[model samples]
Target chain A: MTDTLIVPTFDEPATEAAGRKLVIICSKGNLDMAYPGLILGAAALGEGIETHLFFTFWGLDMITTSRMENLKFTMLGNTAMHLTQAPKMPIPALMGSIPGMTGVATKMMRKQIADLEIPTVPEMLEQITQMGGHLWACRMSFDMMKLNEADLYEEVEAVISASDFMEISEGAQIIFI
Target chain B: MPTTMIAGRPIDVNDEGFLSSYDQWDEKLGAELAKLIGIDMTEAHWAPIRFLRSDYPARGETATLRRASTVGGFAIKDLFELFPGKPAKKMAYIAGLPKPKGCV
Candidate 1:
C-alpha cells in the first residue's frame, strides 16, 4: 500500500481576517512605557487593523492635555537607562537619585527620539487618532485623578469604563503594555 | 485565476476571493461582494466603501479606519458595528482594492 501524504495549507482567508483586531492596553505612564503602546497602535493602524488603545492607571497621564507633552523618564531605579545611555562609563546609581537627573535624562531621551524622527508621545497620539486608531481614557483613572474630559487631549475619543472597553475589545487580540 | 459571477458578469478574483482588478468594480459588484461576506449593503457600509474606492485612486493607499470615520462622517464605533471584526480589511476587499499594504 502506497502512503499518500496530505499537506494542509494553513494560510486561509478566515485565519487572516480573524487576526486583524488588536487592542492595546497602556497601564504604565512613564516615557519608556508609553512608546510601546503608541508605536504599536500606530503600526497596527498602518497595517489596516482595527486598533484601540485603552489608557488606565498611570497610563492615563499619556492622554491628558498637560501631561502628554511633558512625560518624564527617571534614571533612578532604572538600571537599563544607565547601561544604555553611558555603556562605557556607567553613571553611579546614586547619581541617578540626585535631584534634576530625571529632568536631564528626560531631555536627552526626548532629543534621541526626536533625532531618530520618532514622533513624541503627543505627536504619536495625534497621528494614531488621525490615522483611524481609537484612543480611550479610563474613567476610573480620570475620576481618581480629578480630571475632567477637558483635561484630556481632544483626540481621545471618550473617557470610558472598563465595561465599555470590554465591549469594544471583544474578539480582539489584547496586548498589555 | 478564479472568477465569481456578479450580476450576470464574470469578475476575476484571487484565490482568497479578493477582486483581481479594480477596473471591474462597480456598485453592483460591491453589493455582490458584501453579500458573499453575509453583509447586506447599507448606507453605513456604502459610505466607507465608496470613500475607499474614490480615495484610493487619488491617494494610492487604503484609508485607515480613523480617516474613513473622519472623512466619511461616521463615528469609529459605527465602523466597527458596520464591518464587525476586521473592518479595515473587509472594507478594502469589498471596495475591490488590493489587501491594504501593512495589513497582516
Candidate 2:
C-alpha cells in the first residue's frame, strides 16, 4: 500500500507578535533575589511577551514603596558570598550574622550594580511598568503586611488573590522563586 | 554574508534579513526594511534609526531599549509604540544595525 506522509510546519517566529505569556511569582524580598523576576519580566516584555509579576510574602517588599528602595542584601546562610576581589576565598556564613554586615554588603552590591549602570530596583520597576509589564501584590500578604494600595508603587495594578492570579495566568509559563 | 536586491539595489543582509553592511543602508532602505517587517514608517521611527546609525560607530554595539531611552532621549514606552512587539530588535533591524545584546 502506498503511504502519504503528512507534516505540519509552524512558520511563526517567537518574537513576531506571538502572544507569549509569562508569570513570575516572587517570594523573596532580598535585594539580589528581587532582580531575577524584574529582569526576566523586563526581558519578556522586550520580546513582546505579556509579563506579570506576583509579589507575595516577603516578595511584597519588592513593590512596597517604603521598602523597595531599601531592600537588604544579606550573605547570611549563603556560603557562596565572597568578595569579587577575592573570588577564591569563601565568606563564612556566620560573618553575615554580624551587625551592620548587610549594610556593607548592600552598599558594595549597589556599587557593583551601578558600575554596570544597572538601574535601582525602583527605577527597574518603573521601567518594566513603562514597558507594559503587569505587577500584582498578593492580597493576603498585602493585608498581612498591613499594606494598603497606597503603600505599593503607583504602577502596581492591584492586589489580587491566588485564584485570580491563576485565572489571569492560565496558559502562561509560571516561574516561582 | 548573503547579498539580496533590496531598495532597488544589491544589499547585504544576514540570514534573518537584518542588514549586515552599515554603509549599504540609507533612508530608502530603512523604510523598505521596515515595510517588510510590517512597520509603517513615521518620523518617530526615523529618530531611533538615525540614533542607532550614528551611535554604532562610537559604541560599537547596538543600543538596548534602556540605552535608547537614557542615552538617546527616546522613552521606552514611546519606543514600544514606534516599533511595537520587539522594540530593540525591530529598531536595530530597521536601522541596519546588529541586534541589541542587553535584555532591557
DockQ for every model, please.
0.05, 0.29
Number of the top-ranking candidate, with lDDT as the measure? 2
Candidate 2: list runs displaced more than 4 Å. Answer: A1-17
Which candidate gets the maximum TM-score versus the true structure? 2
Model 1 stretches astray by more than 4 angstroms: A1-19, A83-86, B1-104
lDDT of 1 at B54: 86
Docking class of 1: incorrect
Per-residue lDDT of candidate 2, residues A46-126 (tens digit): 888889999999999999999999998998877778778999987888888899999999999999888877889999999
lDDT of 1 by residue, A106-147 (tens): 998898787755778887787677557898989898889999
| lDDT tens digits, residue span B1-104, model 2 | 66777756777666666777888888888888887777899888899889888999887889899888899999999999888778888889888887888766
**Weakest lDDT window of 10 consecutive positions for candidate 1 chain A:** A1-10
Candidate 1 lDDT over B1-104, as tens digits, reads 66766667777777666777879999887887777676899987888898898888887777766567546676665666787655677787789886666311
Output DockQ, candidate 2. 0.29
